[model samples]
Target: MAHDGSDRSGRTEIDHSRRRVLAASGIAIAGSVGVAGCLGDDAGDPFDDYGPQAAALESTAVSWDDLGDLEGELTIYSGRTRDQIDPLFEMIEDEYPDFTVEVDQDGNEDQLNSLREEGENSPADIFYTQSSGALAALKSDGLARELPEDITGAVDDDWSDPDGEWTGASGRVRAIMYDTDEFDGADLPEDIFAYAEDEQFQDVISTRPNSGTFRSFITAMIEMEGEDETRGWVSDMVNQQNATLYSSGSQQAEEVAYGDQDIGLGNQYYAGRILNEDPDATLDVAFTSDDPGCLFNVSGVAILSASDRPNLAAEFTRHILAAEGQEFFVDVNGEYPVIDGVEYVGDLPTVDEINPPSFDLNALGDVEAASDLLREEGMTV
Candidate 1:
């Protein structure tokens, strides 16, 4: 929890022309597509046929006890910090008086490695991480069990695993938070891509992708815009001498509030968490032009492949993904719901209204590709 809120010197921007020019060239040839512009067969219900494989896993009648029963205190290694996960624990206790859910907030890499080495014997039964890289890794290693059929059918098609391994429980958008006092809203860059060249924003932007959250954001960019284009954007970010990088998203938000930097390219939750902790923190979200660059990051929940409590785990998983579970997700956590109906608070734009770029969840399951992209951008974190 060290609060080193200043920009790190000796940090250099990457070369931008190669990727950006190529992407712009391609888009120029293909023509502009509407933000909510539909794709082939993407027209139907979001999760029309999700979880077909998971549906074949088990056919037991879902029960409250089945979902709630924990022979022992169930352990959770979550990406959420103590305050964020605390409300979830309280909700479980109230709903299922029969069992207890114990949680520990561990770093993303630690939890990923634990699940990898320990496999089915791992002490962690459920792992919630901010990025999909670990999920892709677990799936690649065959460490993830197919999600429950019921859970699959409930979430958006874009949110769940087609192969039934892991599903996105909640999502966060990659948005910019700026201090309006220092920069006028009308004068703000219209697209994040402009930050690299916009003279008005020079040395005023900061971000952190070393963490899993930022990793996914970049990966989504590569998928939507292609490798060269994404690489170009990162390079431009460096060339413009834009973006003071940090180790985490919350750190970036603090820099904006203190005026060390005016804008931060990070998740919306980091700003929300800061507000929850400090009511007077000055910050507001900036929406660049809706494109794949405005990536929608998934924070997913997956049952281990070797769980002795599959039934109990499935029950809990269903509860979290269900309508009731979805409501608590937004009401308490401020995350976007994966399920159909849930109310969201805050002044942030709605998912549809924001028209954030869409990325295939299946593609998100590719960790090697994600890792490679990060390295290509000269990102060590």
Candidate 2:
């Protein structure tokens, strides 16, 4: 919305009182996230101090002791695949030899349900998810714990939890991907909703209504335009009769790039991957300009309340948020780094410039409402 890095999405801030209310009311939500394997044994100082107080305060600052003597195994559950985060696992293993991190990656909802069912016996030391929605679900169920104050000290208050249950890691913006041959750049819809109503986009647009991406977009609509408006938009999308509902953003982007569809809604990375694979492909990204439909989603890390290794788990979490670990995204995976100063090699838009309409809810944190909306609209998985 603005280049100042302030959340320009116009999202209304939830006062501490409301957050306490949610914490008390125990409303549940669900979604995806991932974890990585452990590596070598040379442990570094967790609190080596990056620099001045201001610099430390600007990042997810954490306290640390030598990981050399810490003896523990921290289990993590994630929705991100191994291929995407293996390097991170190796880094942790090599850097913190005394602490081993075990990773399990699966779909967002599946991982959350597993944690809930496991209860106190859950092996999960940390929980990582694709969106805030999943964390919200755990929070409602009394499964999430507050993050360490020092670890969260540097992140902007709005970007992190008041109680530190979860915070945005790296962010990806939602955008429209289209076959440039079929739809000229000039013909792209200015807003996301209009794409559903456009006659040419009829049957030509593909979507994943039940997936996390769609849920995030719909949640944003509900937050920005209210429930009625959001529902109306969904109805219009269905009326187009041209929309094909896939299971995920990557698949939808694949369909659009392969000429199976003219346009699709997806995270920038899906489209980026496609272009990287086929430079000759006719696919191109069209970020919404009207009310900017772009949505920012992240993979979050948090310590599970049931973990036996809270201190070690917290240290691992600190490592992930550290400058070196955050920059691993550029060298290892193509995904954006969660830490602020790291550079994102992908051609995605900066989070601040996206100018998406901010609403009262965290897009990922409102899964139940979104799930109900999708079901009410007859959009089953």
Candidate 1 lDDT, 16-44, residue by residue in tens = 24323433444211122112321112222
Candidate 2 backbone clash number: 24
> For residues 1-381, could you state the per-residue lDDT of candidate 2 as single tens digits?
111123223322212332233224432100111122221222221322211211122343222221113345767888765545655666555545565666776778999989989998897878887766777677767887676665666455444566677765555667888888787866676777787676877777777786665687777777777889788777777765546778766678877878578878777778777775677788888788635277655666767878655655655666666544555553344355555555565554555655654432244575678789888887666
Candidate 2 residues lying further than 4 Å off, grouped into runs, are 1-71, 94-98, 277-280, 289-292, 330-334, 359-363
CA RMSD of all predictions: 14.5, 12.8
- State the lDDT at 206 in candidate 1: 74
Measured against the true structure, the TM-scores of the candidates, in listed sequence, are 0.74, 0.76
